[model samples]
Target: MSPKMVPLERATAPAWRRRPAALLAIALAWPLARLSPHRLRGALEFLSRGAQPVTAAEAEDARNAILGLSVRHGGPRCLERSIAIALICRLSGGWPDWCTGVSTHPFEAHAWVEADGRAIGENPDEITHFFITMKVSVSS
Candidate 1:
């Protein structure tokens, strides 16, 4: 028989109960991040080289393709995530590690993958606070 599915009501308790759940997710992602393998790295490099700069739709395709491939083959890592994002930018003619400063947002700074100077993802501005990204020049 198929396993019974638990509803959100059954799974989620309270804010207090969610702490462990959040921690568990981070704990899982941390090791997987560390465990990112060379094969995935190679794939990122390969995809980046093959991908050409294009429009946002093209970039999205590259993002999905590389991320899906990495999840299937590489497991996980910061590199995997960044590379997937970067590949999208590269295909969309945007490079990774691109940065900009926002004077309105308390002098906040943001780095994001871009194509034609447009941010690629939802609220790309949010990335600035989370990661201090540096651009790496990858040889195609």
Candidate 2:
């Protein structure tokens, strides 16, 4: 049987917090996305070293910030969004796990951030379909 997928709940943050975070994500995502995968992973690993885990609330807030920014700018692909989330988490004094993976059968690649082992803002089933090729843990 296929696993049930849970809908991600939107996180609420004060306008003051959301606005600035969204702006930062917008500013950083494009440049980061242009980088090659090796460089991007290295950059994320360097930035997230010794970082602490973000709370569930903080994870959600970062997810929302990325979404808001994506809407204003043209939508960024998953790698860009993941990079933005990781950097935003670092700025917030925590970091989530950043991951990149690909799926066969239908053939797709994706990137995402996870907090406490759960993929933030993603369908659990969709994430399960991908096998992770690279990951950067905040604590590493």
Candidate 3:
């Protein structure tokens, strides 16, 4: 069975029910964020191997669930937020593409998740603004 990627903020499921898992992923991702880019890429790719890809809606729901946990979860911690969401989905045998990139106009970096070729939880500007440096996709 696929991990039910319902938005904790919007779902009928009690907030407390998914809080621990989300917190765990977020906390774990915190340290992983410190890894060198090459190692971090390898780590995420290793962790997500054998997982099935989730639908864009499911991936967005997972991202939103993390966002629902805390206002602090989404904004500046884009790297960690994307990491945590991917980890959460992987733990349930669902994987989304975990990507990192940089935007040139003003020069900034960002990370995000995508599934079914759609960027989950990101605005159009974010999607086009960043040039992807790396992505962890499901193995064929």
What are the clashing pairs of model 2? none
Per-candidate Cα lDDT values, in order, are 0.41, 0.76, 0.79
Window of ten residues with lowest summed lDDT in model 2 = 3-12
User: Per-residue lDDT tens digits of candidate 1, residues 1-140?
Assistant: 45333222112222453344333433333343353345434444454564455566644444444433334312323343444456445544544433223333334333334555455443555544443333333345
Model 2, 1-140: lDDT tens digits are 45433333334443775677667766887798898889988877888888898876788778776665455322336677778878888888799888989998677788888888799877798799999999988756
lDDT of 2 at 99: 91
lDDT of 3 by residue, 1-140 (tens): 44323232332221677677777787888899999999998898888878899999778767766777756564577888899899878766799999999888767788989998888877776579889999999865
Cand. 1 Cα-lDDT:
0.41
Per-candidate TM-score against the hidden true structure: 0.34, 0.82, 0.84
Number of the predicted model whose TM-score against the real structure is largest = 3
* Comparing 1 and 3 on TM-score, the stronger one: 3
The Cα error of candidate 3 at residue 135, in Å, is 0.7
For model 2 the TM-score comes to 0.82
Instruction: Give the Cα error of residue 4 in candidate 2, in Å.
Output: 21
